[model samples]
Target: MLPVKPFRQRTGYCGPASLKMVLDYFGIRKTEKELAVLSGATKKQGVQDGEGLVKAARSLGLKAALKDKATLADIRKYIKQEIPVIVNWFSVNEGHYSVVVDIDKENLYIKDPEWGYTRAMRLDTFMEVWFSIRGNVPSSKEDFNIRRLIAVEPHKPRRGRAKKK
Candidate 1:
């Protein structure tokens, strides 16, 4: 199970919060404030794009990649490998991000930072909401198109050297 961290109320911090969870899964400890700075998030605007997520993860020596128009199969493959994927989507007509931690035959398990817990949604409904955020036009609010995915690849820890005799 992925560690879930809820974004502070009234804070536009879903990106950093989601990133924190993924980092935590990899045993990387970082506070939300540190993650916010690493992700280039601001109070005036949340994570502007997936670039912030990719850069932040890479800064920590992790291989992070952003995939556009990602499919359900793609997410499942990552989860099967124990790599958590952050999905960008629109909820209530507003841009939102969540971590895809697990999946079943009919449902996708999401660790929603905004909601402060794990929520289950049918795969079809999840895809619809995920794909709905699309377009090139920019507005005051966050606008995104073609489902975006930030995959945090697993990194095997290197063993430390033993003391010399």
Candidate 2:
């Protein structure tokens, strides 16, 4: 595991979907409880960067640097930043881009640009079965957000069972 060093450290929140801003944060993916579970650190890494895909891509990297300006922008364009597991572009079609991000039992901060707001996805419900577990995205690209795309999946019932119709 890459030593628990944050990719960047900024002064405050940057607002909206900007990778550069997100990277400056420390705890973007793991919530306090989750961090306690994962790193056993007294402090947590929750609510760091852009969440989901960004976090996953970052952690999986052999080097694990916060997505740089170009990289972040590139990713925002193609991959859904909701789950860190979405390490790259091709996985966009697998419908398996699920990963925990800024989770807090009731809230799950995602980063798909389209997935405006949703929370607590019950990650245990879908662990490593995600799409980009192997982590295979080349370093980000220029004019990344220019493409404007979306990642879709069969909606899993938010509460428990989909109400039996």
Per-prediction TM-score to the true structure, in the order listed: 0.82, 0.24
Question: What lDDT tens digits, residue by residue, belong to model 2 across residues 1-165?
Answer: 101112221211111222221221223333323322222222222222223433332342322333322333333332233323122211233222222234443333343322323224433432222222122232555312221212211123122112232
Q: Candidate 1 lDDT, tens digit per residue, 26-134?
A: 6667887888899898765678787887898889888898998888889988786777789988787566778988888899988888777888989989888884332
Instruction: Give the number of the best model, judged by TM-score.
Output: 1
- CA RMSD per model (angstroms): 5.5, 16.2
Best of the candidates, lDDT: 1
- In Å, residue 21's CA in model 2 sits off its true spot by 5.9
